[model samples]
Target: MQSAVYPSLAGRTVFITGGGSGIGASLTRAFARQKANVAFVDIARDASRRLVDEIRQDVGVEPLFLACDLRDVEALKASIDTARERLGNIAVLLNNAANDDRHRLEEVTPALWDERIAINLRPMFFAAQAVVPQMRELGGGSIINFGSICWRIGTPDLSIYATAKAAVHGLSRSLARELGVHGIRVNTLSPGCVMTERQLRLWVTPRKQEIILSNQYLKRLIQPEHIAQFALFLAADDSAVCTAQEITVDAGWA
Candidate 1:
């Protein structure tokens, strides 16, 4: 599908987390196509390098791919610093790193719970913290935090993921209020059942596919590009006044 070119995005610096695979990879490709200077961090070196090669070949631009573990706040900050040093000031931050690893309630130990929180929620706040000064210096910016519809739908086997996703909205709203004065917009971008490679392999069986199709008003699968398009609007000047809002790309599943 053809998409709009956000003139405002050209030359702007964008920092993304977990941008090696799945939906994060889609965001990296989409933003790079718009002529944005994209810098993304992920621990998946192979996937990240492949994605960079793909984007470079297809879009004629290569995004800066930094290997990072989001659970390490200091490392996360260092990644942001690397982006600033190489790509210029960050104008858009897509807090898209998250793990929706399903776990039963009984299986959640304290260490496991902390690990879940670290992957699904903590990085978003700290990443936002790291970029605020850069955004402020640039006059204004956008922070699009990823949320899951699992929480709203109360999907089973994702207790910790859903809980962390639920917390994302509160974090976003709070950040919006605090950063609005600095012209920084923070909002949650929630997506429904997307058929990413990981999801298809681990979760989407025939019955699961049928259930997803039947529940959402639209009968088609939610693609990463669909989320990327909505995210483009959020990150661009088009949604300049939109903040503290929960935007869903669920195909009406919610």
Candidate 2:
């Protein structure tokens, strides 16, 4: 599939979380290809470094990679400041980092629950807080909060994860209403079962893949690039009027 080019994205500053691998990596590459100045935070040091090298060599525009744990709110804010100091005020913020480990309800201890919420839900709110000023200063900006279809479909073994994902929609809509006056658009981008490397390595057995395909309107599994393309549209000025919405690219799976 051919991707659309958005001239408006050229030279814009974009900040992404968990951008070292999986769907986050695809979002990094997609924004870079648009000639956007990209800066991303991830805890995976080796993969983040490699991503920087890859984009620098392949795209000719090197993205800034900061080693950060999103759970640390202060550290996350500091990383955003560093990115801003280097790349200019962020015009697009992609809250894409999330941990989706399967957990049985009975096995989910309080500690595990807290960690899951920290990884999947908390950072998104704080990240938006960190960047909203920049967006306000820029006159307008796009904030794409990554959500999942797992909760909506009531998938098994994801009690904590599903809870966090479901709450993401509320967060997005609340921020949209609160920040619209400042011209900062906040929307939740919920993706269906995307075939990321981690998902494949950890969960996607042949039988599981077959089940996923059988349930979806489209037989083919969703790819990271597909999600990236939708995100590009949301980030660009093309989606200036779109906000407070939950847009799902699930091939009619919902």
Q: Rate the local accuracy (lDDT) of all candidates.
A: 0.94, 0.94
lDDT comparing candidate 2 with the true structure: 0.94
lDDT of 1 at 107: 92
Question: On residues 1-254, what C-alpha lDDT tens digit does candidate 1 reach at each position?
Answer: 77899999999999999999999999999999999999999999999999999999999998999999999999999999999999999999999988888778899999999998998999999999999999999999999999988877888898888889999999999999999999999999999999888999998998999999999999999999999999999999999899999998899973
TM-score of 1: 0.98
In the range 1-254, model 2's lDDT, one tens digit per residue, is 77799999999999999999999999999999999999999999999899889998999989999999999999999999999999999999999999987877899889999999999999999999999989989998999999999987998999898899999999999999999999999999999999999999999999999999988999889999999999999999899999999999998772
Residue ranges of candidate 1 with Cα displaced over 4 Å:
none
Steric clashes per prediction: 0, 0
Q: List pairs with backbone clashes in candidate 1.
A: none
Cα error, residue 4 of model 1, in Å, equals 0.8
Residues forming the 10-long window of minimal summed lDDT in candidate 2: 100-109
